[model samples]
Target: MEIFKSDKIFDFMGKRLPFLALSALLFLGSLGIIFTKGLNFGIDFAGGTLVQVKYEQNAPIDDIRQILQAHPKFANASITEFGTPQEIVIRISGSSTELGNDIGDTVHTLLDPTGAFEVRRVDMVGPKVGDELREKGIMAMSLSLLVILAYVSFRFEWRFAVASILALIHDVTIAIGALALFQVDVNLDILAAILTIMGYSLNDTIIVFDRIREGINTSKESKLLLVINESVSRTLSRTTLTSLTTFFVVVTLFVFGGEIIHGFAFTMVVGIIVGTYSSIFVASSFLAQLKFSVNNYRAREAEKLKKQKEKEKMRAMYEKGTV
Candidate 1:
């Protein structure tokens, strides 16, 4: 069940410069979109009221929107169908307290009129709390990257760690930028998905790095680029299979998981695709560009040996009563 058998050599590192240039273009374009268009932030981070309602029968969304808009308080509310035609979720820019305790009742009465609809749930977040959560989300992402940097540096080399971190950042930035580009609602669930993406991407990177290290130690390939190219080619089947399987699951979720999980699934789909690409082209290619070769390791080992020899010489001199 292997997609790539016989150790097909694709020369992934051969086009490293072109791939890197394309990635840089994408990264910059995503940044532009993120800054200009901005994200469609949901109630979780924007501070608002979220009401999920189910009607006894299918109701016209336009009629509901019109009725809500007629009222001064609900004029600027956002209304959309949730899971089905009979269910709808409404979001308004205000906390429960600010909107008053009867907010749910008011929506039910106004929208249903004959008490045919029921408010399934109501949630709210104040502006201050929303701001705090936004800050915390940023901090969480930053800290995760920092921790990963430290871990990878300790486990491998600093150059590999830096390249891996950059690749991860590329994946996350592209994911977030996709949200802003598509106007997907950025929520806490999506934030969680992004963090999950970081972990997933890191695993893929580590796998490739491990293979590269093994190749360096065992293979007679003198060129670092050749070793990396061979390593990526060797692991091509595993990376492809894993990404394809995960992609299918996320695509299913995006198609059928309803509005609640739509953003999360979408984020995963984007993350997986970007993560896989970065592991091969971005992370591995960057490692090659950094000149990660046997020479670097040999140089370090030589320095260590020199220090050890110096210490032994000093010990011998001291034992022999020589200055």
Candidate 2:
């Protein structure tokens, strides 16, 4: 369905300079935020031990944090109420076997010498394993980009492949910057969200690229800028509808998904917004900047003309021979 009924022509590519500048500013700002503030890696990457405690009364989250702060081992522990105010979840720093498998006893003894509170459960991850997971996550992101690069290059043109990649990276960098800026826990779920965002952004970009390719193939417009602008304008409705619907769902998830998938939902929310923006502004504008050549189209037309001439020549020969 089309949102816009008018055959209005938008000079989207004409005002690309300001948009490109804005994109650059945002991209560099995101990089700076990432390097300076850094990601708040969770147990999946940073490695840590978690303990769930059930206090006899209110969890006393502030008191527990104050106590843990004074202790050398848990000086930087994470303390929060899980379910009811009486149910507390404490995360101990360090991924050693002792912290992982035995921190429960230490926490129980230190928090409640009288043994009033109960140590509900304890979970752990080794430092080595955490390092491996981090490496693999990086690999997964890199591999996905490489695959997209190769696929787009083979499917369309190198310019489009590069443009789409730029848009994808732009979307990811901004999304990750949001995570670091807000100090969101970068866990396995967040990584999954990043990958999902990459795919989502790529799909949107491909739609624009596909329209541009169609415009070029059909010689719908003489100027590359017109082709790009028309193509983007044509697909604008589809992009808006898809983005709005997906955004509504992710916003709902962010509100109600709970802490278990909170970061994931937040990532998706950022992805949808930034992904749509890059698809229209970044990907297509970059093509406009490159002055995408029509030499390939000229060559194809030449080939078609050559075949037509050959067919005509053969027909003339047959008519002369009266065969």
Candidate 3:
């Protein structure tokens, strides 16, 4: 089905300055939020205990919170309903293995003195391990971007690669910034989501870059800006269709995937939207601003034509002499 049938001719490059300015403000604002407010690190990144408890019936969340607050050891714990009203997950900050063992007993005694509640699971991550994971997560994200830069530069031209990387950075920064702004809990799953976003954003950018390269090589458009605009217009339908389908799937996951995958789904939703925008506006606009080194391509083509003419002249002279 065609969502957009007519070919669009949007002057994306013509309005690059304004779009870029908006992106800059967003980027800076996100950075500010991250630095000031910081992310709400989950148990995976911050040392903590996660205890999952299932009650025989629907338990009052406020009663559970009040009970935990009554105890000195569990006073600062974060308690939330996991999957259903009958199940709740309790998170406490610490690396102590003893706490993991004792927490279940303590919560069970406080909530259900007769043992009506069952401790389904108790997980703990040490502070040292959390620190390591945090470092590795950062490294993984950095390495992925570096590898993408190398791959794109080799596959296309350096300018396309640079623009694509910048666009990816923009997508990631905005995604993380949104998470921080909204106080979403950051964990390994969210880190994985950010990496996934990078890959998705890169794929979208590469598609646009591929189309632009094809236009530059074949189209007789005198201006690079016009070539870019035409390329984007040609791929507009495809981009829209792909983004829409992906968005529907992610939104579905966000709504129904439960707390376990909530962060992942949220990241995907943000990434998809930002990625689509960057592919069309940010990446393509950079190409237009740079003029995509059209002069070099034109000069190369002219040299090739000159060489062909010289060869033809020599061939003609040789034929005449033979005659």
Candidate 4:
């Protein structure tokens, strides 16, 4: 699907500064929001017992809170409407299966003494286990970013790698901040969504970088800016098609995927939008900031060739026992 004119040249760099300013605002604001608001970690990361109950009629959210607070065991339980007014989910910190079950019975008796409310589901995770998972999750994300850095450096130049990394950071941080802003439950599924976002963000940036490299290699493009503009313009169609298609699918998931997958779908929807923008604006503008050009590439290559010859000369000397 050709969303943009193939032959038309777009001056993406013309409004680079404004786009960059906007990205900075989002990136910084996301960071600030994350630090202040924090994530509402699910049982996967924050050890807890979850009890999902459904009543025959509209659930009494306020009464449920009051009753739970009155009972010492159920006190501090997080209560949220699961799917509808009739369905409710209660979460409490701690992970004793036997005790959680006992507490579930207590909740059922207190909330619906008539037994009309049904216990739909229950889950538990140990505090120690949740701590471990949280640590591992952070480690996983950190390692992924490091690996991306190394991989991009290998595939392209350091300038491209740095630009790509910054864009990805922009994408993920903002996504996380959105989660924090809305107080979405952070679980294993959300973690998976984030990793997927990283991959998508990288793919988009890499496509632009690849096009720039191809353009530079084939043409005597003295000004890297011109080549960057042309490369971005050429790849716009592919990027747009991918993003739009993915957006539609995720939007569908968000609408009908149910409560279990709602957070995951929401993360994907936000990530796609942020990833697309960062790929086009954040990554390209940062790359431009490095002042990299065809001349720089040529110079770097020449230096590599010089060092290679020097190494070869030294190897020959060593082979001949000439120090």
**By lDDT: ranked, best first:** 4, 1, 3, 2
lDDT of 3 by residue, 119-207 (tens): 99987888889999999999998999899999998888788888888898899999999999989889998998999899899998999
How many backbone overlaps does candidate 3 show? 0
Give candidate 4 misplaced runs (Cα > 4 Å). Answer: 94-103, 298-323
Clashing pairs in 1: none
Better of 1 and 4 by TM-score: 1
Error of 4 at 195 (Å): 0.7
TM, every model = 0.90, 0.86, 0.88, 0.89
Q: Write the per-residue lDDT of candidate 2 for residues 34-87, one digit (tens) a residue.
A: 999999998878888878898787877777787778888888798987746778
The global Cα lDDT (0 to 1) of model 4 is: 0.89
Sliding window of 10 residues with minimal summed lDDT for model 3: 1-10
TM-score of model number 3: 0.88
| Lowest summed lDDT window (length 10), candidate 4 | 95-104
Highest-scoring model, TM-score? 1
- Summarize candidate 1's per-residue lDDT along 207-261 as a digit string, tens digits: 9999998888776777888888889988888999999999999999999988789
Q: What lDDT score belongs to each candidate, Candidate 1 first?
A: 0.89, 0.86, 0.86, 0.89
State residue 49's C-alpha deviation in candidate 3, in Å.
0.6
**Model 4, TM vs. native:** 0.89
C-alpha lDDT (0 to 100) for residue 116 of candidate 1: 80
